[model samples]
Target: MDLRFRDPQTRIGNLADEPILVVCPRCSRRATVTPERLTCAGCALVRVRSAPNYSVWNGPVDPFFREPLWLRADCCGGHTLWAFHERHLDLLERFIAAKLRERGLGDDPGLTLVARLPAWITAAKHRDEVLRTIAKLRATLS
Candidate 1:
């Protein structure tokens, strides 16, 4: 597919509708996390936040619970690849997959998720490796 991304200026919170993948603190297994709670089916563990005060996060952790994300893999020589959820992954995949990526900075550039992505992720030399890492992350979804 010849995809093109014009930087929709999508913020990290825009993808909050989907559950973030997180590692269960108890079982070290995969779990689903949201602003309110973290649920682990493998060990039947659940933790709810009293006050859901979270900011937009761009790393390998749930914004609310602050647990390590379940969907992360090593890539680009010492850099870690991560996504908040399926929707976030979809966005990253499209941006990286595109041969033509246009930077459309909105009023507040920091709020734009793609703009905040690490430099190595957008580097042409690392494109193939990044795609491979993305595929590996997707495989862990199930």
Candidate 2:
């Protein structure tokens, strides 16, 4: 089966009225639905409404950290926006670790450590961590 067919490119505006199933770019999870705005079940990040065409997902990447990472994306006037949050890094790490464990994949302690930091700090320390993770996840499912 073509994975792309599983992950359809949905218009951002459609999320306002009901929950829409979407593939998470950070973790390769399926059937993640956004009931209101985009909120990841895999992470504690919350995407909040902003201007008509803009929205922001701001929160800590992990529970161990206080600083929050903010992501801004163009909504294309669809009444919604696309963004990611690294808030609750510890939670994210635990989630990922559990998934990896389930898959029989060894944990990368360094990566887990990095995931425990705020998004900004992680981006600065490892510039491509988030992007790379997203890309890798997309590739795996797609």
lDDT of each: 0.85, 0.32
Candidate 2, residue 18: how far the Cα is off, in Å: 7.9
lDDT of 2 at 85: 27
Per-residue lDDT of model 1, residues 1-142, tens digit only: 5677888889888777778888899999989987788999999998988866755476778888889988788999999988887778888999999989888867876668888889999899999999999988898887
Once fitted onto the true fold, the runs of candidate 2 whose alpha carbons sit more than 4 angstroms away are 1-29, 32-117
Q: Count of backbone clashes for each model?
A: 0, 11
Write candidate 2's Cα lDDT for 47-86 as tens digits: 5434344332232221112122232222223222122222
Per-residue lDDT of 102 in model 2? 25
| Candidate 2 Cα deviation (angstroms), residue 1 | 30
Which candidate should be chosen as best, given lDDT against the real structure?
1
